[model samples]
Target chain A: MDVVLQQLRHTYAAPGLEARTVLMIDEWQATSGAQILLRGISGSGKTTLLNILAGLLPPTTGLVRCGGQSLYALPEDERDRLRATTIGYIFQMHHLAPTLSALENVEMPLVFGRKLNAGARRARAYELLDSVGLRDFHRHRPLQLSTGQRLRVAVARALAAQPALVLADEPTAALDAESSHAVMDLLQESCRRTGATLIVASHDPALATRFDRVVDLRNGALHEAETL
Target chain B: MYELKLAWRNLANRPVQTWVTLTVVALAVALAVTVIHLNEGLQRGIIRASDPFGVLVVGAQGSSQQLVLSTLLLQGLPVGNIDGHIFEELRDDPRVALAVPMAMGDNIGGARIVGTDEHFFDLRSSQQAAPAFQLAEGRIFAADFEAVLGSRAAVGLGLRIGDQFRPAHGVEPGLEGDEHAEVHTVVGILQPSGTPFDNAVLTTVNSVIAMHAEALAAPDASTTTDHAAGNDHAAADLVSAAETVSAAETVSAAETVSAAETVSAAETVSAAETVSAAETVSAAEAAHADDHAGDDSHAHASAGQVTAVLVAPVGFIEANQLWRDFYTGAEAQAVFPGRELGGLFDLLNQGQEILILVGYLAAVMAALTLFLAIYSATESRQHLLAILRGVGARRRTVMLVVLVETVLVAMLGALVGRLLGYGAAAAIAGEISRRSAIPVAIGWLPQVEPALWLLPLALGVLAGLLPAWQAYRVNVVEKLFPS
Candidate 1:
């Protein structure tokens, strides 16, 4: 789905402590099925902006509109439904549920989305696991898999529901150079095949050539960057 | 559906903690359910034991509970035997439908030698069609020294048809010098009644009375001939006639076994009657008529000495009339076995109720344990819960997962508790049967199951709420990528 952000702001609050503004944006938008890369250093609110776009965290000011619906303007349940069907999130770390197997981890979104029954869910999960080339290790738990393999399982999970927008935050942050390139290739290839709007947030400037547009976040403000 | 599957996988992964919580809940429920089933089955078994005793039991003037316990349930020594004529009086009473006398006090190898008439075997009371007791083999005892053993008594004492055993003076076995010299042959074996009576040894009432009279005369006699002559000359005549020509041996040793073997010449002449046992309308009447011929030395034998009388009046009004009349008398008291026994058991039921409350408290503790289990586990899974929320699972879905996990634990515990309850109840019933020598069976009391099952599940639901609330409020962005 196409995404729009208009004058959004959010602050972090803690008890008996300090409140800090973490994210502020005048406007940002990603066209439908476009591949975009967002680059930022640590504490630059890369995760907070993704959270707003995913309908997870409502910003303190302004609205994030996805598929012509202002996410925060709708009820919390409706926002949750939109997140299940339209937006897919990949965290900084490969956060597969430790108890679930690789295939089950891929099936998580489809299970909660309730768009398919058990048989269809398993078929889709098997297809995703096969595409990631971890079909043989699909029954393996998170603790049994190598870091690269777990990240691959997480990628398959993000696209399990065939969501319109795929947001990947530091999908290869903890990987070595070769493993990072391989994981990025697999993630980009899967998104391209599914025609999903891909937004990858990372501080890796070397990844600028992999996207159609590249932007950098510094001091909670967006900056256009020249593609490498 | 997705939420429950997730919850189940989560719990299944933590097998040790899940099993520990389930066992705690099961133990609490098992303890409580055993007490409940025990109390219910014991009371029901006790009541069922008394069903054959007719409407009212009249015995000596002492404890009415003891009278019922001893005469109806055959549990202990009677308060004291009422006058034998009282049984005779009740038998001929116009208001009485049936009056069978019970003479207890003697035992054969730990089995009570119940001195009663043929009517004791099969009571034709209005309660049911089938007789309470039936002869499994041989025939009912008629002449003195002929006895019928109960099913358990035959096996426990290792006696069969035509086998002989002497009666001990008291109700318990293993009393030295208390056994009668009279060797009563087992003429029959009764079918198991599943009551205390399954271990009884039944003989004629007159035989019991005559045996005791003969025992009473033995200490006073100067010689063996005098011992037999002083009680009843017919006894001496019969003992000598037996020794001289293998005549019927008269063994008047124990007080309750007085006339068990005191067969006179007339008894020898009626040996054909003893075999067929058809000559006697009831065994007691035949023994009285044939053995003692107008002998004044053994006045007790002629009059009879009975343990108790089972009285069933013609109607409800007649029952109350007979009960009141018996109550007015100073000699004995009449008790409706159920009402008298119910009052005693109600006190025990109150104790069971307290145990049920303790069971509920245990269930609450089990629920709290579940809460702690989920709460502490959720603390570590905040990251995981955030991921689930990030993957499009609603806050309510997360809450529901916790609820489903806890409730499933409770339901499984209840299922296991019910089986444990039955096992514990059977164990208790077995112990009671072993100690009392009575076959006590387990019974299901109505309206008692839901307490065993539903309460734990409800408590599980209640306990899951706080931990579920914790999961529901998890911050997706904060937990997923913690700073």
Candidate 2:
């Protein structure tokens, strides 16, 4: 699925201050199976743009079309269903349910989809866990795994339903250099295997060199750079 | 199903909070159910004890309330006995359908010995009802010393047919010298009537007179001996002949006996004519002596005095007339047992209403506890709920999960509380049965009260509303990505 943003804009209002635009993107697009990097410092609206692309946050002015469907124009529940079936998101903190095991967390999306029986869901979850090199630790809870392992489990969970678009916001922000590289390699390799459009939001500029395209957010504006 | 599974898993994760909330709900439900059971059971017991036929109790001039209480509830002291002639007057009156005389003030092994006649067994409080007394075993008292035990009395005293027991002179058991020397034999056992009658031992009025003969005898030696010798011979002859003769015939026969000759030949009589002559002279002397005996000794062997009379009028107008007649009479006071019982319940209803109020307060407390448990759970699981929403659960699903969790807890508490209520009522009923003659009926099921379960369920659902709304309004973006 292709992602298209047409003159997208978002604004936030303070209690006593004027409303300020947080994001303004003019005609940015990414093709399917493309690995794109969104790079920005803190408060630069890189996360904001990723949220809009995920259909999580609505744009104040403009249209967000993912796979030719107007994301914001659909009802809230339909958009949620679209996100669940078509988009898999990875947060900066690896928001896996603390109570559920690694395998169970990966199976959570399948529960909401109602497309797989319990046996099929478990089999798919185990396959995802094996793909992420954490098959032996599938039964372990989030707290029982190391930082890199937890992030890997989150990545496997994000791609559990074989979504068309995979969004990772600062996926390796809290990891050491070696762990970060390993997590990024696994995430990108999984996305390539699934033929999913990969969009990674991060402040690290060096990581942008590995992507097919780099969209930089500076001064609330989008700048597209050629793939390395 | 998934929502229930998730809710269960969430509650399981916080064991202490879950158990504390459950215990609070259980305790509140138990307390409320107990109060309701007690109030309802007491009301039912009192009403069952009340006679619907409207019996007018005529006793010696005294507290009519006390008279009714003693006669109907079998509680309190008996007001002084009225003239036995009052019973005959009521029996012969055209307005009176049945007039049964009662002679109380005696007990055998904690069971009250009610001195009445055979007519008492066949009598019913109303024309539409069956006989009030039904035998579970054996038959009614046919002889003076034969007794009919109530169902509970037979069980309590461990007496069966032909078992003889001496009764104490008063209503209480275990008086050192109050027991009568004459032993009465049990002839029958009555079925459970769920009334004070279940704890009574019934006998003929002649048995009461025979038992209290020594006390009722005159101070003069000749009069005492004449009555005793006459009663002994007639009783002996009646026992040997198996004759169902009236007390008047026995008295007339006893008056004809010469005191000296009857006493001398009482155990040595070999000829039937000599025995018949001795019985006649004894009967003539007894009647002559009874005429000389003053009213001071109202416990006379003859039917001259009685504890009270149970009078049933022919109609409402006749009943009112009888009541007016007895009310204005200088010798006795009359009371409607049903009305007196109603007044008694009216006094008890005030306390019952207070108990019901307390029960309501417990239900409210239970609701508050449920609310707190769910609210705190929702507050702590906001992130988890937000994750669920992010995973594609709708707002309605999340809300339903919370509601289901609350309702499950309430259903469990209500069931447990209902069981506890029944247990408490049974224990109380057991204690009451031991202390009093009245047998309180313990219900097997709480069918008498639906609020025992329904109120708790409603409260639980009501308590879940706020928490469910909170879950419905949870912001996935804000909760999952807190700044």
Q: Which candidate is the best by TM-score?
A: 1
Model 2 lDDT tens row, A38-89 = 8888889877777787777788999898888889998887877766677888
lDDT of 1 by residue, B1-483 (tens): 777788888889889988998888788778877888888778877877677778999887878888888887778656666666787778778998887777764677778777777667656335555777888999987565578888888999999887766676545565465565455778899887767888888876655544444444353323232224432222222222223321122232232233334432223424243322311222333454444333221222224456688888888998899889888989888888878798869887999889988887887788888888878877777888888888888999988888888888888888888789879999989898765655667766559777666788787888788888988999887797678
The models' CA-based lDDT, in order, is: 0.74, 0.72
In terms of docking quality, model 1 is: medium
- Candidate 1 Cα misplacement greater than 4 A, ranges: A15-18, B125-128, B168-170, B173-180, B206-302, B437-439, B444-446
Looking only at chain A, give the TM-score of model 1 against the true structure.
0.95
Q: What ranges in model 2 sit over 4 Å off?
A: A9-22, A37-46, A59-62, A98-157, A170-195, A202-211, A214-228, B50-55, B60-66, B125-130, B143-145, B168-182, B206-304, B313-321, B327-330, B442-454
Error of 2 at B160 (Å): 3.3
Q: Best candidate per lDDT, number?
A: 1
lDDT of each residue in B181-262, candidate 2, tens digit only: 4456777999877778889898765555444442232213432332233331112211221123345544443333233234
